[model samples]
Target: MKSLIQIFLVSALLTTCINVNAMTASPQSWWVGMQTNSLQIMLHKQNVAKHQWQLMPYSGVNLHNIIKTDNPNYAFLNLEISPSAKPGTLVFNSAAGGRFEYSLNARKANSSKRRGFDSSDTLYLINPDRFANGDSTNDSVKGMLEAANPIERGGRHGGDIQGVIDALPYLQKLGVTQLWLTPPLENNMPSYSYHGYAITDFYKIDSRMGSNALYRELAAKAKQHGIGLVMDLVLNHFGSEHVWMKDKPTADWINFNGDFANGKHATSHARQTIQDPHASDFDKRQFSDGWFVATMPDLNQRQPLLANYLIQNAIWWIEYADLSGIRVDTYSYSDKAFLANWTKAIMTEYPQFNIVGEEWTSNPAIASYWQAGKVNNDGYTSSLPSVMDFSLQESLIQALNEDESWNTGWVKVYQSIANDFLYPNPDNLLVFADNHDMSRVYTQLKQDLAKTKMAMTLLLTTRGIAQMYYGTEVLLDNTGSNDHGDIRIDFPGGFKGQKSNAFTGQGLTIDQRDMLQTISTLLNFRKQSAALSQGKLTHFSPKDGVYSYARTSEKQTVLVFLNKHAEMKSWPLHYMEEVLGSQIHATELFTQQTVNLNKAVTLPAMSAVVLVIE
Candidate 1:
């Protein structure tokens, strides 16, 4: 017993001495620390005697001045972890008698899954202020323009980023793959800038909408749920009340500061002169320097410092938010040279990033000039990857509104696309039936549900990225006028005490639910269909009121027919025989019914059919 007690005492003393020596010998030169709501870290020490790692308690370890320590230590690190650690780990070696080594292994505590956006995404474009207002706390900000009034169409209704973040599941159920909120940058104009066009600060998110950190969290949360966030950016102008405007950075900080040039009427013929080498500088300045409104001052991209600042601001947002894509507003108004450089820099950092520019020209030639890869007559180069298909929107509107005529009427869309040769790559174009600037698609089609469905079918099956304006699923309308304020009315259920709520699908007429379901089904179907994305497009326009197209890929083929005849008509097989290529089987995508392509398929008046060839 005495001998055993002596051995135990000696062993304890040796262990204590060794531990003290190990801690003192190589006073840790480096340490790791982490603090994030989204992740956590765990530390483990290697036990060579046990031939395994033993978990170390680093919950409250201090990591300041880590690099000032003496010994070198190796540690394994994990990212996007969870379960929370107060500090982290530090490891060192003992050199009391002989050299001893210690190392650390950092394993992720809990990791969330990763997701990516894809081509089948049905983008929902929302002006957040007009969407929903879940929180009324931040309605009135300090020192900002405009008061929050839910009843007023043009006033800030307190619809914020948090509101949208709260409604993600509602959108997810509606089969929305992406969300495109309008510009949320601070717009500090005294009044009527609630739409966020007049940016006061590029770096700060509009306080009414949310904080920068909140926006980043929104993006991270949206990504976790398999949703893509598209940021709306503006490079053309800043709010006249912008702080920099009060104290100009340089003589050329703003374009034509000596005399403010009011905006000129957008004429494609006149604007196309921008690409002409012989065009007078007066004409160029008129287009580039002119202000969109008295309250919005055109920015001078020619100023090198301002240009760099704008470019860096865009990159900073992308990096900070890990954004899926960008939508540049007023794409053509900026300097052509500056746009090329800006786009090149963004594309360099994010190779797969997507961007859609708003050219807002109905003429394909004028619009195509701004799209990337268009070889201009004057050797003008552009780096823009995509453009909003304004031509398609114009054609769709005219088709729905015009009376049937010999060479006009619904055939306008067929002819419009026939001139698609103007575009170098039409597939990259963003096709939308309506946006914030235009009359709602439902109103344009005279509130005809069938026609609205037909229009949406065309947009979804067409050979370009499709974007749906918010409230299209529920057939939201602007009543009659196309005034800006009237066009961006408040969304149902966006505010407290609202009689209707789009999020809950309450107070909606049966017709509204039917339209919403139609959109939901088609969008979900589109999520799985590659033909709508990667397929080759072949279209035919044989008559004034009839149009058809086929999208074929390696695995599938889809046929779409649009008939705007006042009466039902049977479409002959020969019209689409070239694309059918001896079709074996066909099924309607919307109705899920087998279709007989060999027989003349009768279509209802002003109706469309999307048939999937099996």
Candidate 2:
């Protein structure tokens, strides 16, 4: 409504008052010598698109194009950095007086050749908010919508990255080679943000948890102790509190026109739609583009700009934090084409890096479809390296809880592993007894210590990469409730007012101490066994209440027996002659005593027997 002269003067004043540091830039920094020569920087400021951007004279660096979106506050600078470019500050000046300096830093030596987690590693999943609280000062961070409320089940409990850093020694001693923490990114929701699934900011860590620098520090410290870090990422949806929910970059930045009807736009969770040949377009849309919950807005990755942003963000975290792996939450919920491009970009950058997606289906056919090397009828090629073995997890729990029958008990486990042929690389799958989203294995087995032992032993000695919930070693239980907060209980001695200390083995119940020893023994042994980690598996059909298998490497062979009987059973060796290979003697892993393999081996009731034949 103002006159031309008045508006001109106001615009001039705003440009003169512009603070380059105050304006935000996605990938605020960059590095030279990346695998890709193309880089896109999204600049966000008041009327940022109004000014034409120019790059100061720098060798081998050129501003190829500037993309101005529908939003006047956003500008995308497409840059091409040739190999001749050196590491330095890039000065970007606007037509007016506004200027911004972006760093083009040097990459770490051989950064692209970094190795990721594999079958040799044991992943321990920790819900950081419930793990430990090393710094109480940031318990109630200012400006965060939800404050610390330890008494409330769903409220934040103040566990920060520093706590994880402090526990590296303990975790290293426990023989876990990899740590998979739930999303530690910013989740500025009104409540129940402690679980860290609904991320508000993709680039920054939650202030209540810790700063981005502290997260990098934890990764470095973990690496020093022969441990790797696996970051959990949510790609399908984000917290509604994210800035895109208000000032969107594009008209279709969020799916379904950014509208969340009361349970109307919710996802059908029909994961099979992605592979079902008979799926209708309506069903596919309902499963893929629909919102997860009212508080979470599904992202429209089909938009090329947003797709580039997400792909770049993931690579940025890997480079910035030196992460060893990534675990994608709700893997199949995003646009399949975008997921393919996203993973292909990452794997192209770091060919050896590992990424495991959470398909969360008991059907091996559906879960295996997402893994790399899968040949699908629809010609959908995935670059994902691994998928969680939910089939084995569900089968293991049911096997222990059910009575021995022709189709029950040990047969369930045998049948579960029998389905491994469906996987392109079964050894790459992640096997776990329980995770943050479900009841603890101890509770699922009705607090039967023997069955828990059997389950842990089988997981540790079986095929695929093994992951255990944080407090599984201590038998953390949430028997009566299916609440998420209860499933992800705080570790013993992590917070104040805890009677038992799992770290120090003080004041723990005898059963807890025993279970801890069982887990520690298996983990330590597995660390040295090439046979157990990545090996050829041979199994016999389930006979009576026993299921047996052998994992054989070039140098060592590991024999495992899971007996669900009520009394000790003598398992014959003739059934496994091909796997045993005329070995006369073997050492029991638990007792460390040599036994003659010419006859039958004794397996205790409701227990596992793991032996090494070298």
Candidate 3:
């Protein structure tokens, strides 16, 4: 009897241990990790049915453990499944409880071959809703922001990841090295949110644009075609309807939620406070925590969990998609300390990675302070490598619009480059004519094709990195209003039922085709020119409305001349006599004609030429 009692006691103890282990396990938890050319997944305590435990076998499921640990409660399972994984729910049986289910989605591993920023690449920025709509099936998603009319400038015409993928060849042929699309993260809001500025879920891609799998495919395919992908990241705020807003993670997760905290007025002076240790906390909060727009709720990165989550999400995308770079929106609006840490961490993993912040300040000092090498008075450091040269943009617009004058006018462009001394490396700055926010460049230049070509020439041949707004090559216009919807117009023929398609080379006006061909030729020429890629830039502004520069190295030389004034201008060869050093032969890049270097050259009004000295 005593022996029987001992056996029963031992059996009871063993049963209790098993039950404890089963109860502690997370039955609903599922995770993915990267493996060699695949992903490995581990499902914890998968409960398929009541009182029965079964493992559903899956073939072609590659699995790897990112965090291999004995601690069952906190282990991360990574796996790579076949790219053709069926769209279905994952159901499994739990040993101690009921069944569990999770959605299985295809995710691609990051590419290992490509890394870092390239100098020769030109980025084309596009607002997806305004770009193209390849699929109409998901145009009006349930419980999503209502679709607006495509003709009604502000309406959301469904432009998904697939649309971009389909248009890749068109962009590539135009000499675009990188494609920067607006944030495609989930922004399930109530109204007027087509811009994708207000993000709700950091981890999930907007379903309306297609699933996260499609996004990864876009990135991979883009790289294969020699086009890099630049993701637009938002760290300042999220839509008020975000899930976290309903459930406060901590008491101080947000600022002034109970009362209206109207944001500070736009000021270039505020950047001075970012590096000042003596700056007031109120000013700092206003700069970092203030709302960008009323509908978007500001995020407080001081909260540890929120900061960590954001940092991890960024890294996950970079590693998962093998992104070439990230274009951070409203970059200065985030906490300075957090921005520094965020950039530092990302740079540590990907040293050659390129990150361009949107400072949007017209002052060189303010913009330069945020760049990687500016030595702030207070010793505050930022790891950001590049900033959008808003200062140059401001000068360029003014120069293009005003009449020629001795002190100002077209000379403002020359004056703008003089401010290049303010930047540690002006070559690293990102120069652009216009983006999605402002008026289109062609519209700003009053729809003059000659002037448009002149601006394009200046942008491409300038010292800094160049980024072209999408549709600029085709002279797409939004002249009547500055509304975002007006600026982001649909690309003709990107949709299925459209009368014309830019990709098929149909429905384009003669002018549009000419512009496209011109841009393509220039891009292809730049691709093979070593001088344009890494040579030092030297400019000669002998007179107003005439600017000439040479990008030269030991073996190659590229000379660019811009004549903005009407009629022909005679430039004496003696002005560039120094540049003619020991070189008697020069070929016009655009016309392919050899020109005499000993005499004056007649340049047509508003004409630009790129000459390769051989």
Candidate 4:
């Protein structure tokens, strides 16, 4: 009888341990004083809905309700945390005798008022997997689907948060004020996961990249170097292998009943349909509801529970990581209504925070509709503060590669910038020469060093936030193909057996060294130039292959001239008299030569000239 009793007790204890271990929460914890009082926590486990839950009495905390879904594995708890609630733990018990603890932590001082990246900041976009490998031990973590294969372009290269932390001083010296790393969230896909678009777990960082604590440490160390961190977030879709895919909370958790139908439900990429007044309902649905690929399942943000989960998840990360900004990938592919709510919630909590959305369109009309304060004719409003300047990006490429003409060349760039009026706040736009999705600027310019210099000069001197792809300063190029893997090539000296070291400036050709120096000079100068950072822009029409513009402010005036001629030209400055006023002499930014602005300025062949008048 005693032996049988011991066996029964051991079985009961094993069952209890399994139950406790299986239980999980989306946001495992909360803060004491947020802007909002109500919080919804999603709990997941085996047969979680079958058990009745009761919260242990805690001061100023009330269990408003428990919502059970169609699936027995999921339960949602709606709680009201009052302002007077203090930081403590709340214990909950189920009728089946299962218990779990949730924590309510105190908020950091002035957490909600943290400043975000702005036009004055230059963002350096890094592919963490290709930047450097500081912790090779975590490179091929056990149980991870993919391992480090540095030789394979598409395979993981083992770069982690520590690598970025190691290179903070190099980035600071490179004149980068902000670092925009590609989505470092967990991507457990079998292949092609290095890009980080297909996120499997939203709350957890990829072990191959680093832990959540290490990510926060990167943010802290970056701050010490005067660089803010910008997290790249994917809201449109997630990896098909996400846990929710196997056990959905709601029937509509994944779009199309979680069925791809073998490309039958692929997105039409009709982004303009969002703003098109006459777009068909079928087209709108196909564009917004369709999946990017079979491996990437489109999320149904219309589901209230999922919506709440995503919003709270974003807020939780912002608080946890002390982030400075967020870059939303494939911004318009998500449900339009949910997008409005999502952006509004984030902005409400952090009024000074900035979020840039990638609309990926050259038409400012469509992109402008998503910016906050846009007065849409269809009565739609967005809380998005910034949009990528794709029009200028395309036009700048054309302006550099094509010959000057009445309807071509520099005119394209001029017309592109002229459309800035459509934007509510043009200065908030993100200007970049090349991003990870496209060919490097040097390759696009056909390895023309002079033209590449002109492109960088215009991007940095323009009236917007600037972002440079990693290794652009060293003229990293993909000459043969535009493969994404090639575009995101590994940085020199980040891994073993590389002859060049960008950090130490070893094995770099003369041209590479010059390009690095030129970009460094322009970026550092931009940091100190009020006229370039946030000022009024007055531009002259393309004349004799020269595109001239002047950025003026209360402190000083900056004149920029992009001369495409093969020989030095004396460009007349009479057209800029209104902005120049009584200033006669100016200092050249690059050569530091004093120039007389009374008549004309001498511009170098196929080069950019920036002159400052005080």
Candidate 5:
């Protein structure tokens, strides 16, 4: 472990920009292709904005525009590449006594054809810092401000990309086709940098996590394992410790730029107001520009240079890592105009790529407004393929906790699913019972094993792309606290010497083992079930404490039954006659038991049953 750290440190020292001030170009390399015909090269030097810059020669690339920001230290050179421009180095000579050189990296063949995740894929969300620590040496790098402290609930826990790479086999066995990792870029804040949301360097992966190359390695390995990688991105803000924070790129590079001196701002957290037509200009301004906290600064994407920089950063990641998709954080917080361009640009570059935005609203109307085909009343349009299904998530949890009654129990869930029309593509929405930002499903269900199983069944088999947080298979829970540190705890057996090993199924309770097995069984079945993935879904409203739905395709039909009662009984099966189409019998996937569909179906108390109609 010590030797690995030594090698990592040596490697870091040998390559890449640890110091942005020393480099002529912000990004040392960029892509050259038809999709990305023009490149915006940002040069940051002492008073670099004061002078004129030009291309060193009339090569295949032509200098289009040199944009100067209010901040004298930063300048943007917009250059267009001719179709004949071969991938090579292009130098920009400036009167400021420095020449910025940038390498035009060759785009992989069929780069624009990379496909992103869809309903067929299930995402396993992992917080890399807490998932596992594959290497011990990088736990506490010499110069990094925050050292690894697993004891401190909110501190860095030493998990990195390698830990994830090593756990690919376990994920494959669990049957998730995609891995949605939290942001891994450099979050060089003085403390609480483990979340990785407060990115200090966009181009550089955090050293604690390993190099940027290692991140790509994780992506490549995941691909080989039939697992797609969904990178979490934050375009709304950056850590105050970011290099650009010290050097003013423009007067409006950051919202409330003066307030950033101290770090915190008077944010309203009124997320819905961004979509409200009745919202006052002052309130909208406050919500959009307000600093997130003392350590994170809200970016002013209205500035063209800053907007271009962020959009280009997204492109760089897609090409560099060959990512399956991106999960945008705080999606609506960015300037609306800038966001439209950001999403449009990415889709233009890779037409098949998918991007899901987090709007975090429980209103279907509010969330639907962010989907690609939404025709907004205010004339706002979104290029986003999907959105986090917060409305369905809230209803699912609420429906389970309440007793069966009119608009009380299963009806709440039925209504939520019925609201699917609000979205352009409901199946594309990222659906989950819980995520890193919320309580775990186990705890959210009040630790009731039966209810938890029911929740998992709906998430896995029902409409939409499912996303299960890591440790969900084993019933990970935060029983008493709402703190994020408590929510994202260590996986029982991910690290070495843990007495409880989820991987090996040692030190696990009978209940934990049961839950784990049940989750595994359903996931593996869903992996091969075309009906579950590509079928048309039709559900009946809840009656007699049993709610039912069916996902049917040309080849198969899966009938899902949910019974909320405490005791088993043969409920009326007449409602499914039409969907089953005279099929009198079916086989339960989980138990392999055969039952007559013509008669009443008997199921366990508070249980979810997936029956394949013959």
Candidate 6:
């Protein structure tokens, strides 16, 4: 081990080097909201903690406190801004350094009143690096650690915010009301910068992706087209290469002793065990404190300062970009109490906004525990409004692929929905057939066009916010491999001179075109149907290779039938009196053909049929 004199000498050298440079402050811009009174500005400079900071007497802003840390490179300045403070720059000076100015801007009109995505919205998830390269010039931005490489699956492909802007029209026409892009923040990693999950600079967008202004522009443009933007955020950990790794402000800024190579600090992937009543302290610590990956250093939210920093970081993004929602990655991996507080803080600010946590579990019991209003035995409460419906996704695949049985196939789909009692509000769940990390839904059903369409139909008509992975409409599949790099294939038309263009519908197979049309029909119809958006669901038990469900709103009712039988089969309607009571007529939503509800409804073999009560 190094001696005390050696450690002090090293620290002194760093402190001296940073001292020669000017002081830096975070949150270059601040929005003064109704409840956003005090703002914490973190100052970064060598030996910054050694000097006291004071704010000049200003009209509407006052110095609350200056919080210094163990590291000499950082200090926190808490400034309370009164309502009278107009949009201008607030200056703070330190005897140790010079002036640090932070601009305050008036929030946009009706910002707090902005609505988050819900069941009424269809989320279209896209990987930016694989979407499209709008500007080739930005493909290889100078100084960025990574270079653009289309042939490299895990490398950056130059897809930026401008590419997303160009696709807004296409996405809107496809009937998606919300666009969820993977993280666009700066990830200056040596490799795998395309993923954007390993955030190096939270305040700035990845240079390769575009500037922060462009990201805000994407949100603005999307909003103009009646589309909301959902930003993917990570609260569990950040890229290990983050600048903080060089000069940490506090000893516990990161978990695992700030060392991922340590075998003792490796993650145990024991998330569900967090809710176990008999779980040991060791197991609980391992789940919450371990590093996410060697390149990602787990954060210690138990530290109140770090917790507030993260909470403010999320709020900063929402306010900066006018975001409609946030999808938290690896929700259950962070400290449980910190997660609770984080959600509460966001909800308190944006009561109408929505935040969906990525709890990738096949068990409804565990996923439900993360939703708001869950009365856990351990007294755990979550302010999270929505969670990804991994259970339903898995069940949908099984329901279509496996044969019907007592506890398998169609029964799997039925029983999963029956577990809705576990969630505080099942309609708020984000349901999807597959996402970036999973095998494409088309591949999951063995590339059977009929099964793929049926799955899409079910998800569109089901009782939650439906999300479709990019290229799913065109049957993008990776065969049977679970490799994430392959699972997220580039959209056929994203690049120039591609084999086929999804945007222009060029060079596509008959099967692909048919699947695309099938999904387009269902999504467009669902967009106009309140019954499929915000409605009550009633499903019956599977019977004779047939499963049925209904979504009914005030005056609109939608009935979905899934038939796996070999030949055309008709199911009696007399038992469906609750939904079809006294209704003698129905309209086939897909074909727009009228039919009699009093007689048995005929279902095609291995197909999904939708009808509206008339």
lDDT of 4 at 343: 95
How much is the lDDT of residue 270 in candidate 1?
55
TM-score of each candidate?
0.79, 0.96, 0.81, 0.96, 0.95, 0.95
Model 4 has an lDDT value of 0.90
lDDT of 6 at 481: 73
Considering summed lDDT, which 10 consecutive residues are worst modelled in model 2? 8-17
Candidate 6, 474-522: lDDT as tens digits: 9998995777778877888888768999898999999999888888888
In the range 1-614, model 1's lDDT, one tens digit per residue, is 33422432332211111232222211111122222221112111222112122223345342221111111221222222233433333332333232222222232231112122335667789998888775687788887877787667677878889988988888888877788999888987778767988998776778888877778778888877778888999998888888657655556777776235444522122565577678887777778777777677788898765676677667556655667788999888888899998888766555667778988788888888877789987787877778888888889888877776766666788788887898888888888999998889998888888889889988988888889998898889886788877788778777777687777889988878888888888787777788887888898763757678888888889888887777898777776767788785788876788878788887778778788985
Question: Residue by residue across 415-530, what tens digits does model 4's lDDT show?
Answer: 99999889999999999999999999999999999999999999999888999999999999899987888888989978878999998899999999999999999988888889
Q: What is the lDDT of residue 85 in candidate 1?
A: 37
lDDT scores of the candidates, listed in order: 0.71, 0.90, 0.70, 0.90, 0.85, 0.85
Per-prediction count of colliding residue pairs?
Answer: 5, 0, 20, 0, 0, 0
Of the pair 1 and 2, which is ahead by TM-score? Answer: 2
Query: 5 or 6: which has the higher lDDT?
Result: 6
Alpha-carbon shift of residue 393 in model 4 (angstroms): 0.4
Write model 2 residue lDDT over 441-526, tens digit each, in one string.
Answer: 99999999999999999999889999999999999999999899888888998888889889889899999999999999999998
Please list the residue runs of candidate 3 whose C-alpha ends up more than 4 Å from where it truly belongs after superposition: 1-114, 258-269, 275-280, 496-500
Better of 3 and 6 by lDDT: 6
Q: Which is better, 1 or 3, measured by lDDT?
A: 1
Residue 240, model 4: lDDT of 84
Candidate 1, residue 29: the lDDT equals 15
- The total of clashing pairs for model 2 equals 0
